[model samples]
Target: MELTDNDRSIATFTMLAHAVVHWFELAIPIFLVVWLDAFEVSVAVVGVVVALGYVPFGLGALPAGLLADRYGPKRLVVLCLAGTSVSFVTLAVATSIYAVAASLLCWGILASIYHPAGLALISTGVEDRGTVFAWHGIAGNVGIALGPFATATLLLVLEWRLVAVALAVPGLLATLYGLRLQFDPTAGLEGDSESDTNADGDTGSRAGSAFVSNSRTLFASSFLLVFAVVTFVGLYYRGVLTYLPELLGGLPAMEGIEPPAGLEELSLGDYVYVGLLVAGMAGQYAAGKLTSRVAVARGLVAVFVGLAILAVAFVPVSAMGLAAIVLYCVVLGFSLFAIEPFYQEAVAVYTPPESRGLSYGYTYLGMFGLGSLSIAFGGVLLDRATVGVFFGTLSILALIGAGLSVRLLTGPSPTDTEVPEPTAADD
Candidate 1:
């Protein structure tokens, strides 16, 4: 399909905004390692403190979506980038753990706006939603990989504070890009009718009733099943990524490896972690390409089944040899991110144009908000059970998601369905 200049511009800005938001979000984990030495706090304490910021990151998405629907998405995109830049700068000057925690809290609130706003824009503003979403997912993975990579690399030359200040530059540039960017409101919608509806209505009673009505409509729709599937995916995502490095460290292949003599003490596992994330870029691209060819439900089932197998295989493969472990990382990373575009497409398929922002908002709330709890849950499992048990649990979650995807397949394909409009019938 031939993309117009407007399509290209919206896709570029949307992808950049996604990358900048994730870069800031993922950078915190790298800093958590730094804080261990800089502040002399226990790991458990740091985890809880960081959660203070993370919880808001998940919780704020719904409101951010609501706001994007009220205002234009462009405004929220600019705000997310600019605010994140400021938050990173604030993190740069922090002298205490409490200050760091507070800065992160600020960052969380700011960064939370992007997923809902960016996805909504792409889902509704880009004509080639599949290709754009695929590229968007790739950009996100780049940010996910770069955030920690940049932080870790910069720490070798400068203080962690300086590193944070350096990290803010991209957000500042993205903010500027967002200022000049414009999107066609009707680009991805089925028609102009819904887009022309008065998104902002009267206050007081009208607002209250609209909110209640919207809530009820959402519950009554297939969006609930989509949310459930996304939630299961989130739990798997969080549990696996949060502990991946530590788990890789326990691999036999990494047992005797050493960092290069001139560098700081990087481990084999760290390199493996980076490699896996890099591999996910291919997965994102492939998934995006497949969106036009494969059915969403079928693709989700295949990806999740692969995830389940990988989850079970990770332990045994790590014990085999370095070659085997590397292969495992590639496959695991690919499956981990490959499901994103399909599920994102599913949201647009299941929801109407008017509620698309809120749909993405609640989708991310499942992906990030409810998913955040998996960190603690994974921790508890690690402490109480065998590593085998942990992988088993992840497999179960992926299978559950796959089961839900099968259920979705039994209904009308998202691609085949006409975009619905909000009306009395919906209420």
Candidate 2:
């Protein structure tokens, strides 16, 4: 599809916004080892403290979405960028683990606003949303790859604190750029005002009823089914990614390679990890392209089925020789990230334009908020069960997600139909 100037602008800024937001979010994991030594704390303790930050990242989305509807997406997005920068600067001066926790907490709150705000913007603002969502997902994967890669590289010559402060620079620049960008608040809601009018042709008197109707419409079975599918996807995502490195390191193929000193030590298992995540960029693009041709539900089913197969294969493949291990990482990486755009697209497709922000808000709450529970649950499984058991559970989750996708496929499609504009109060 050909792109217009507005489409290009929205995609460019939103993609950059996605990259920076994820870069800040993922960079924390690289600091885990550093924090362990510096703070002299148990791994479990570090885990709990980090959860403080992550929990809010998920939970805050609902309110952020409400705010986006009331105040506008651009304002919340700019706040997200600037607030993330400040959180990093706070981290740079941390003197204790508590301080680190506090900074991450601050970071999580700010980071929470981006998904609901940014995705809402794209879904409502862009004409070619499927392509835009694909590029947006790729940009997020770039941030995911760059965060750890940059953190690991910078730690070679600088302390973790300094590296964090340095990382904040891009967010500040993005904020400045956002301040100048112009967006039409009603870009995607052109027909909404007329649709919202009552039989008598008055909108103001029925404003309250319109809100109730929209709320009911949002929680209807179709949207709810999609929500359930996305929640399962979130569970699978968090469960697998939380311990991927250790799982890979424990493989027989990775044995006997002497751990390097300093920054090189940080590079351990990273090549495979980064390679898989970087390959996901292609996955995102491919999924985007496929959705333009296929039904969203069919695309979701294919991706989740692929994910389930890969999750089951991961354990056995790592036990094989080096060639098999590389193959495992490549396919696993592609399958892992490829599903994101489909689910994102599903949310936009299933919900009305006026409530698009709210739909994405709840969507991410499941993805991040409820999804954060996987970290703790995964840790418990790892301690009490075998690697096969842990991965098996993830495989089961993926199957559940696939089952949900099948259900969605059989339901009525909600494909970007026009809806009434929200009343002033609804906004």
Candidate 3:
């Protein structure tokens, strides 16, 4: 199937906006310690704050998706991006920890909109959805990689508030530009339609009733399982990445650094540490490509298993160990993103198109809500133990997640049927 001019344009805007919003969304986590140092907060407090931002991602994600269904994915995305931008700018003006905490809540809510709406849009825009989703993952990674460098540079030259405001502006502009994008409403362009059946079809009365009933049934079971998996995924993802800097800082290799003037002060190793994130980007993109060639569940199992092994490998701590950690990180990127396609595809299979946003919202809620706890737990663990111990714990969690992912292989049930055709009625 050929992409219409409109499809290409919407897809381009969607991917670019996704990247920018994600960049700002993820930037804070990588540099949480900087905020704590700059504001005189503790690591535990920072963990709480970091986790709070993610809470809305879980709570607001489904609502955002439902709203997208009611209105349009494109419009919800615009709103989410703009809202996130404004919320982040609030961080610029924060004078106390409470203020920052509040800002994070707002940011989480806004950041939550991307997955369901954006993924649905991409699913609608392209026939080869794996490719679209792959690009989506790549876009997010681009944002993720940019976060550390952007935050680090800004901290060097300006206050964090100024940096946040700068970050907010781009999202605001993207939101406005998105407002003007034209799209096919029935074709998953508008929010409430259940099927892509043509306007001329007289079988609506029969199909609509059955579709609604089936959707409700499918949604219940799928929601529980999806929620469990996504929550675990989010928790693991945010937990690991949020603690990455701290983890690296505490490594035996890093113990050699001369005591710096302040924790906020950059270390020579910080630059090298940033490069590890770059490897994550490479890993994610590579995994995205590989998904089309293999089963996503199998790929996830491989990545997590490797991570578990490597996490344990780091216990010995040597040059080989460091290389193993880097290898683990690279594979982590691949595994993390590889899992997403399966998730998205499952949503497509299990959820009614009308409630797709809701499906995403619930899944994101698990990811963000439960995941936030994981982040805090990571911090607590770090406060109490060594990097090897913390990562080793994460590796075990990864193994558990791998086992749970096996459920995906059973495949989407019949109630999860997606519309086979894209038509004007889809709008």
Q: What TM-score, over all chains together, does every model reach?
A: 0.91, 0.88, 0.76
- Is candidate 2 or 3 superior in lDDT? 2
Off by over 4 Å in 2: 33-45, 185-216, 258-263, 415-427
In model 1, which runs have C-alpha deviations exceeding 4 angstroms? 33-45, 191-193, 197-207, 412-427
Lowest lDDT 10-residue stretch of candidate 3: 197-206
Specify the highest-lDDT model's number.
Answer: 1
Going through the candidates in order, what is the number of backbone clashes in each?
0, 1, 13
RMSD from true fold, candidate 1: 3.2
Model 3 scores what on Cα lDDT?
Answer: 0.65
Residue 310 local lDDT, model 3: 58
Worst 10 residues of 2 by lDDT: 197-206
On residues 248-269, what C-alpha lDDT tens digit does candidate 3 reach at each position?
6656665555645655565534
Winner of 1 and 2 under TM-score: 1
lDDT of 1 by residue, 46-139 (tens): 9987887788889999888777765767778889999989988998778889998888888889888988888877777777788888889999
Better of 1 and 3 by TM-score: 1
**lDDT, each prediction:** 0.81, 0.80, 0.65
The candidate maximizing TM-score is 1
